[model samples]
Target: MQKIRYWVVGGEYTSTDFETLIEGTERVVGPFESRSDAERTWRYLSEDHRPQAQVRFTIAQEPQGTMTA
Candidate 1:
């Protein structure tokens, strides 16, 4: 199974605002079927929110599994 992590960067925004942004941006990086989904999600989140603040994706892979850190 693959896991995707989507997050926002920069100034803190309410969950509602972030959700709205994600809704619009998800398509840009999503519809993935593997671990690469995380990359797409991150790109979408970062690209959309980076301009407002500093943001980055921290991906960690484990021997048995992988997760976003």
Candidate 2:
């Protein structure tokens, strides 16, 4: 089975449309073992940056290869 990992990606974007991110504002936060953990971090980041209209964060998942039984 493929082991999946979660991550918190995104940061300050150039516009409200969120089509592009600023040059140095890209923020990637970790390969969490569980989606809940990633979500926790995401909530914190989002709330922390709530004052900035351009700041944003989202949860992402990726495969971490197969796991042996």
The model with the greatest lDDT is 2
Best by TM-score: 2
Scanning candidate 1 in windows of ten residues, the lowest lDDT window is 22-31
lDDT of each: 0.43, 0.89
Candidate 2 lDDT by residue in tens digits, 1-69 = 566888899989999999899999999998898899999999999999999999989998875564355
TM-score of 1: 0.36
Clashing pairs in 2: none
Local error of candidate 1 at residue 43 (angstroms): 0.8
Cα error, candidate 2, residue 5 (Å):
0.1
Q: CA lDDT of 3 in candidate 1? A: 51
Q: Report model 2's TM-score to 2 decimal places.
A: 0.87
lDDT, candidate 1, 1-69, per-residue tens:
645434322333335344333332223232344557556666666676666642333333333345434
